[model samples]
Target: MPVEIKLFMCRTDNFGALLHDRDSGETAIIDAPEEAPIIDAITHSGWTPSMLLITHHHGDHVEANLALKRRYKLRIIGPEAERDKIPGIDDTVEEGSVIPFGEERIEVISTPGHTAGHVCYHLPKAKAAFTADTLFAMGCGRLFERPAPVMFESLKKLAALPADTAIYCGHEYTLSNARFALTVDPDNAALQARAAKVEALRAEGKPTLPTTIGEELATNPFLRWADPAIRKHLGMEKASDVEVFAEIRRRKDNF
Candidate 1:
């Protein structure tokens, strides 16, 4: 059976992804913020969720897990380390574990930092990664519960993926993120061009998301702190990659 990956922007700018297998008729939801949107998506798509994949224990991400489980009677799975935080977790997976989602499999990558148990689900066959609050379109998530160094390492793990991997992140923070990215890498032609494109898309009331890893590697200043040009722009003397990343993130937090 072939698998279908459907991207749903649910719950007031939060992303809720659904993966469905045509032959088996099994569907899985990657993160649940609320039941209304999730139920709407399932009904609208004519698919029933067999499983719910939680990236972390953040309420904005997992608040609806129990509600949805009661409604759909679905299995809830998430990072093993955060098992105590999430309710009704049937399976706790770690990095490198592969879980069946319909006909395809999602490789669990433990990318802590956003919340210490944050993970990105990578479907190699689909070339898509559900990066909840770790890597955004043109920006990275704020280092709220963790330090900058840890988030940097988590981002590094994702940056190693294939260039074409589709990044389905958590929020609709792209245009704002692009604006900040340009502040750090103003001379980057790619960054400038992408900002313009994002502007047009936003003006048209469209989403500027699901950015490719290749595009991020080239234009995202958060991911490009190691580039000599960015380091020079930051006016740092012999700065390590993490140092540059820290400066960029600090500036972004203020931006």
Candidate 2:
């Protein structure tokens, strides 16, 4: 059975993706931002959600879990560490657990620091990853609930993914993120090119997501903090990886 992955942008730029197997009619909602959008999509597709994959306990990410669970009696799968925060979680999955979705299996990756219980979902057979607020197209999420170092470490784990893995992040922060990326590595030719591209897309009101790991590695300054050139451009000399990451993030927050 072929995988049917349809991504939907919902609720002020948040992503609510639907993954299904056409053959089996097995469907999963990855981080629903609102009940209306998820319910609307499920109704349009004529498929009831079997599983609700919660990436984090953030309201924008998991707010609709209970509503959907009560509506469809769906199984809510989320990180074990965030059980206190997440509503209606039926299964607490760890990093190595593989959850079934029709013929596809999603491998859980424990990515803390975006929130203490943040986790990204990876379907190896599909080469797709749902990264919620941990890493963005040309940036990383702010260290809201945890320290910068912890977020940096979490990013490193995602960055190590196969270059071709398709990244479906939680928000549409790319255009603004690209603008900030330019400040950190102003002379980067690839970033210059990407910023122009992002600008054109936003001007046309298009979504700029599903970025590849390779594209991010090449253009994202947060991921490039360890690069000698980016560190030099940021006016840091002989800094540790974590320090460099912190400085870049601090600059971004102020940028």
What overall lDDT goes with each candidate model?
0.88, 0.88
User: For model 1, what is the C-alpha lDDT against the true structure?
Assistant: 0.88
The alpha-carbon deviation from the true structure for residue 205 of candidate 2, after best TM-score superposition, in angstroms, is: 1.1
Instruction: Encode model 1's per-residue lDDT on 1-255: one tens digit a residue.
Output: 287777777767888778887877888999988778888888899988889999999888997898999989899999998999998899999999999766678899998888888888998887889898999998888887789999999999999999999899998889899898888788999999999999999899788878999999999988897788888888985999999999999998888
lDDT of 2 by residue, 1-255 (tens): 267777777899898899888777888899869889888888888877788998999889988888889999889989999988889888898888899776788999988877888999998878889998999999888888899889988899899999999999999999999999988888989999999999999999988978999999999988997888888887787989999999999988898
Instruction: Show where candidate 1 strays beyond 4 Å.
Output: none
Clashes of each: 0, 0
Candidate 2 local distance difference test against the native? 0.88
The superposed Cα distance between candidate 2 and the true structure at residue 196, in angstroms, equals: 1.0
- Among residues 3 or more apart in sequence or in different chains, the pairs in candidate 2 whose N, CA or C atoms overlap within 3 Å are none
